[model samples]
Target: MDTPSAAPHRMAPSGGCPHADNARLLARGAVVPVVLPGEIEGMAVVGHEALKEFLAHPDVAKNARHFTALREGRISEGWPLLTFATVQGMTTADGEDHRRLRSLVSRAFTARRVEELRPRIEELTVSLLDDLARAAASDGGVADLRHHFALPLPLGVICELLGVEDRHRDRLHRLSGHVVATDIGPQQVIAANRELVAVLGEIAQARAEHPGDDLTSALIAARDEEGDRLSQQELIGTLVLMIIAGHETTLNLITNAVRALCDHRDQLELVRSGHATWGDVVEETLRWDAPVSYFPFRYPVRDLTLGGTVVPKGTPVLAGYSAAGRDRAVHGSDADRFDVTRPRRGGAVRSLSLGHGAHYCLGAPLARLEAGIALEGLFTRFPDLELALPEGEPPRHASFVGNSVLTLPVRL
Candidate 1:
């Protein structure tokens, strides 16, 4: 593997075109200093080795409350969405707090639990495919596969797992859109977050009064050997985390995979010819066009040196997962090429798309299972699936965090 070039100091765009901005910085080297939203200065760590190390480092913390700037009141809470990303959740917690939250949630969201949903996932996939076929027939043999198929499967599965009421699904879905929207203003973000929190809080309260077999109910009833249980706030946060992380990322995974397959005819042919499995397509998509381009900000507790760069304390850093996924040093010079038959490294699923270290995605198994089933069913049902806009370009969600197509029009 070759070493990344020296880190560069650069100013990231204040807003708009974040993907392009990130791509420019990533091209500079593995580690670069950047100014994020609200003029927060930090380092962007790219490449496989550098990201892995950054994620695992003890001093490179996730708790924003512990950030030196926040502690000393150097910066106002200008970004309301930052609260959603870094408050009372496992995603932003550190040490014992994170361990306790993760432990409780893990009991309710285990691999066996996810595996049990496989049959139901398959059933839902078939149902959605049927709906897509009807939609295509009505729309002159063309339909937005993303809306009809990719988006709904994971949303339905997650709602079922969390026991979200059927009536509330639409509201939850809309609010979630605002939560992840890159163009939304700070006030709008806060408004969306407030509504989402209220809904989750109500659901948590209801689950407390009357428990059920769903994961939300299980979480409400869960207790450690020490009798430690989740607080009401913790419960709400956990449910929100599960819903957003569970379905949103999986939706992108499916959409991105489908788009990749459609764009690369040769790779698509390999899978269509039965020379590669759907699982291969899913993994390659994950590595080539990661669903979450950058993991949310991780703040350093103190000044630290990482990947040959000195990062100041309280700086908000993000692991550039999208760039690392295609780093030539790690995946070879052909890393930029999308190849479904790319050999697995030691038979381990190595992409940072799902995350790494202590904060590794708890919902990874479920996401992978859902995507695999979705792709297999989708292609098997519609053997003639092709991009409706082959001559046109697909628009991306305007998010630094989310790397998803706005719509994937297809002919079924």
Candidate 2:
């Protein structure tokens, strides 16, 4: 598809409206499907009905063979795939096991706990932005936001939490990106997993030797408990998850917030004026353009009809969690537009970005806290901040699992 010397890439053909794509795939009443045309071949499901079948279908299991010989062709990269073997061994373990594993760290992400961390998060955000401002001023008033702030906040937070040294943060970034992004192939995932696992093993081993006030130490305590707690392997997996989830996901959150604020200067100024709160910005950013464009583990457990079309069992049904945020039935005509004042209707205690139902993201609270504080602190420190290079198309992440921006080059 390209010249011999050209770099290879994936192409997603788009219709003008993103909301329509999802509504078309699934919905009823005031329905509008937002789906990419021709992306999935031989699929009769289109628009509202399709979307309903996906989210509410019991038969549509998240579990599927990585390699499926579908009439549409081979469908690899399903739940429990080899790439995630390192993160979730029994990826299909949907019920008790999943809950138990998630519970080990879930307590830390409760509203009270996350709210307690807000002050610290705000301080960290301010510090990072101050550093960014200095760098921008020194570099002729231009700094890459990703390099200066987006990457470091989560990196430092997780590193401090996990007991990983600052010396090897670079390696973590490379490994994290390789596994999360499709730009790298299977071999890269294996190597990164092995290396990261080895590092976690070492750190975990040390925590058992010399405990500290950190997540690794906490995990060590959990593992050493006489009763049924975390195993050594779970320790490794959670550490990897924490580092990857903390950094990769939050990186996108920060970038997406920056992108949204820049695109809507009026909203940014209003937030700056205290007309809206940090929670509003965080909520709007998560909705306007989710850091995760797709849900990784959602599956069809049985035959289901979204809109009206029947999606057969074993069909790899992926929900656009990112897309679902902006539906008319859910959000109305202003769904496509980023409006911070929009009532918090969907988050009935659980934000859609974190997801819904049994397998909700455990890190939601911490993530929201981090983003809210990060945005507020950064803006407070640099009121005149604007993108260093605002023109042209912004960089997007090339990965199936994450909705991330590769780089956010900006001027403070």
Candidate 3:
């Protein structure tokens, strides 16, 4: 039970590699003190057991109501990470509130419903592959798989599912960059949130006028057995969360899988030779390199000691998913190695990449579905795809929360 007597490390706001950062943090302690982008002090749970225990602990909560700093006005609305705390969605709700908010949209993400979207996912995958083929035929014989295939396939599916008009897609994408970003200032964060809210609010209004056979409209008209409906703010927040989670995570998942397979040709061959399935590849990629590195704003409802550090009640804690995924204590000394043949008894991945327990990502099934299909279709179409970086490796996305490269340029 070591306590922090030293100054906390300031986590990189951008341009920091998750693996390197996690390794450094884990070396310090399972629970290490850190400073967020806005110089906000917090603790990061990087140990697998500690993180899982804390994440599922009865006293741990996701709602901002338990955040002492915010309640005391030590943190303000203009903070870049304030959206995570103040958002009125499942991501920021707890207890009955969380259940109610999650329940309203749970059916849309159930395995059965997600599986039903397979055809559409497959169709989108093929179409994107075709687009990639066209781009590969151009000068340099290179294509940015991130922008072309990895991004659009899931974005298209999520946009259509939410009844978001194509006109809003580009703007939503740009705004979402601001949302996930930790590098921006207060004013930029405020502007991004306002515009995002307005755009989703417009979609909600349009759906109200002309109901469609989409999730957005379904949510607008949905009610539980108790007849509870999503309030206006919850509606917009839900839309923002769904749009970001639906596409952003899956896109990164697909891109990371490709990069991993390319870097480890042996693993790629195993998949090609039928020694492992695309499903195996997807799970391994998630464990080896998670899509989301750090998710914020989980507060302890009561004082709790995790990995030797006593986190006071109402202190914000970040669930270090990327760190936990490759935790050598849980996954063994070979945890850092990418092995597609990693065992999955009962098809369960022993990693916290999709989270755990109560707040496990509702979109997990859909994200896996999209990644598996996208990877299979991508490699099947261009088996010879290789990294086309003239400079050793492509730069990563400028966000601590997102764990992916900026561009996955590949020679087709």
Name the top TM-score candidate: 3
lDDT of 2 by residue, 1-412 (tens): 1122322112232112233444443443221221211233212222222344454444544333421333235433431223442255223335666767677777667798777777767667778888887888898888889888988887887687677878778888887776665445445556766887887787778778989877778767877874367777767777777778778878888888888888799888777787878788888777767776654444445554555344445444445656666655555677778777664456422236655555556777787778777887777777777776667666666554577566777777
Which prediction has more favorable lDDT, 1 or 3?
A: 3
> Which residue runs of candidate 1 sit more than 4 Å off their true CA positions?
1-23, 74-80, 223-228, 345-349
Which segments of model 2 are wrong by more than 4 Å? 1-81, 89-92, 226-228, 344-351
What does candidate 3's lDDT look like per residue over 16-110, in tens digits? 57898788777777888888876678888988989889888999999888988888889867788888888889999888989988998898888
Is 2 or 3 the stronger prediction by lDDT? 3
TM-scores for the candidates: 0.91, 0.80, 0.96
Per-residue accuracy of model 1 over 45-92 as CA lDDT, tens digit each: 886788888898988888887566567665544363466455577988
For model 1 the TM-score comes to 0.91
In model 3, the runs with Cα more than 4 Å from the true position are: 223-228, 344-349
> Candidate 1 clashing pairs?
none
- Each model's lDDT comes to 0.78, 0.62, 0.87
TM accuracy, model 2? 0.80
Using TM-score as the yardstick, the better of models 1 and 2 is 1
Worst 10 residues of 1 by lDDT: 8-17
